[model samples]
Target: MTNEASRPAVDLYSDTVSRPSAAMRQAMAEAEVGNEQAMEDPTVNLLCERVAALLGTEAAMFLPSGTMCNEIAYRVWVDRGEEIILEESAHALHFEAGGPAALAGAMVRTLKGRCGIFDAAELETVIRAPRGHHGQRQKLV
Candidate 1:
């Protein structure tokens, strides 16, 4: 029998504890920042432009965080009172304080899966067709 111990050069468990390098701190200190809501932030614009070019898309939006992205996407793709299917362990499902229900006015349908992963067949089962005036439509996953 053998016992071994290992130490990591860097830990990546959470961004809350991550520290910026001196170079990164310097860049942040010198960065030109502007109102991002009006698309006046040159840094955000450049990031979006570069991402769009890399992905071969005409345009891309630069959102500050994953929470914002989820809310925006849900609002765009799913109408009010519509249903969004998600794994029970999904970040927005568990951590976003019912954002789908509150922010997007969406009804969340959770599916149980091993390690937050479900097969296509399981997904197909929950997919509901629009029953106009009768039921909330299932629009997004």
Candidate 2:
């Protein structure tokens, strides 16, 4: 692996890290524009339609970013006081800014893993009850 100092310098902290290519700039300049907030934007509509079809789903929505997408999914999948089973290092749990608990009103059932992957037995064990009524119930999310 390349050392940090030897590797090509590029920002990895956010999507704003890199500048747009000339081709992308030209495309944007030539693309048709419409009102996104009013739901009339052609580009946004095409993205939603394309993703939904590719995913074999009947409906779709274009969220601003991955965090927004995860937050929206969390809100829909969770109920008040419910818990979701997730890998301990998963983006939904770590990088989502506490959206599961804050926006969805749900708790996390974080399971430890090695190299971001978990075994079936480990998942099953984590899903088991906490031996009392006070334990939070786990959901698939």
List TM-score per model, in order.
0.78, 0.76
Per residue, candidate 1 scores C-alpha lDDT tens digits across 34-74 of 99899898988899999999999999998766788899999
Please count the clashing residue pairs in each candidate, in the order shown.
Answer: 0, 0
Model 2: colliding residue pairs: none
Among the numbered candidates, top lDDT falls to: 1
Instruction: Give lDDT tens digits, candidate 2, residues 1-141.
Output: 758797557755456656889999998898777988888999888888999999999978877787887777777777777788888888777777888898888888878887458999888777775546676666553
Badly placed stretches (over 4 Å) of model 1 are: 1-19, 129-132
CA error at residue 99 for candidate 1, angstroms: 0.9
TM-score for model 2?
Answer: 0.76
Where model 2 places Cα greater than 4 Å from the true spot, the runs are 1-20, 130-134
